[model samples]
Target: MTERVEVRQNVLKENDRIAGELRRGLAERATLCLNLISSPGAGKTSILEGTLEALGGTPLRVAVLTGDIQTERDADRLKRYGFPALQITTGGTCHLDASMVQRAMASLPSPDLDLLLVENVGNLVCPASYDLGEDAKVVVLSVTEGDDKPLKYPGIFRRARLMLLHKIDLLPHTRFSRDAAVADARRVNPEIEVLETSCVSEPGLGAFVRWIEQRLAEKRQAGRPARD
Candidate 1:
């Protein structure tokens, strides 16, 4: 057990070192990177689709990189939306690491784009430990997934800067407790910005887009060359 623990620690340390480099590279190019994480069926892809549509023709130039255990389906879906999309099939890996993201970044349209949205492989546990050098980590939770998700997956909830409670259109049909979910998420992360969204009804989609724009603007401003 001790040896396993040490190995895991070493791997994470190396990943963190590489993530730091990736973060600096993104900053140099003034790209705002977002690491979006969630479990399977959490509506991550749907949320991305809606978000891309909302951001379309806006001032922010954005792209997406989606990860999966297998298949290019998600990437293909995003491409239809007319955004530059890349798919990282992790084979058997449960999560994406900094190294994978670094390679994907190279193939992506020049980091000149205002934003890069990374939809991490659909898993809650392993992905939480890997830092992809994103400006903000956003976790998506659908009401159907239950209100206890935050407590069950506190690590991701605690690490995330924002939480999107998706599937608001289905709220009327399900027994999921929106207030309980938000309360639990806040309990774990008091500073987390919570937003409700429904791709079907388009509720809160504008706010999500605005939030991304704000982050991109900040990253661009910070990356600007120091003027005398």
Candidate 2:
């Protein structure tokens, strides 16, 4: 058991080392990297689709690196918006690690993008533990899922900078309590920003886009050289 624990720690240390390098490299380019995490069928791709459509024909150079256990389907869906998109098939791996992202970055059309959204493999458990060198981690929770998820998966909620309460269009059909969900999330992470979104009705979709634009602007500002 001691040997097993030691191996796990060593693996995480190496992962963090690589993640640090990736973070610095991205920072130098003023790229805002966001790691999106959620369970399977939680609408990560759908939100990306809406975001890509909203940001299309704009000057913002955006790209996506979506991960999955086996298929290239998510990447395919995002590419329809005419932005660069890549699929990292993990081959049964539960999460995307820094090394996987580093290798995949080499294949992008250009590394100078303003926004790099990484849709991590859809497992709220393991993906929360792996750092892909993102500026922020966004957790997506669909109303179709349990409202108790924030309490159940405190690790992800605690570390997330934002929680997108997606699929709000179906709230009338479901028993999901929006107030309970937000309150519970705050209990774990008081600073976690919550956005109620629905790709179908498009409520809060504009706000989501504005949030990204704001973050991207902030990233660019931070990367600027200080004037004497």
lDDT of 2 by residue, 1-228 (tens): 355443335558889999999999999999999999999999999999999998997998999999999999999899999999999999999999999999999999899999999999988899988888999999999999979999999999999999999999899999999999999999999999999999889584887888999999899899999999
TM-score of each: 0.91, 0.94
Tens-place lDDT digits, model 1, residues 32-144: 99999999988889889988887786776788999999999999999987789999999999999999998998898667777899999998888999999999999999888
Write down the worst ten-residue block by lDDT for model 1.
1-10
Residue-pair clashes, model 1: 0
Which ranges of candidate 1 are over 4 A from the true structure?
1-11, 202-204, 225-228
Q: Which pairs clash in the backbone of model 1?
A: none
- Alpha-carbon error at 173 in model 1, in Å? 1.7
Give the Cα lDDT of each candidate: 0.89, 0.93
Model 2 CA deviation exceeding 4 Å by range: 1-11
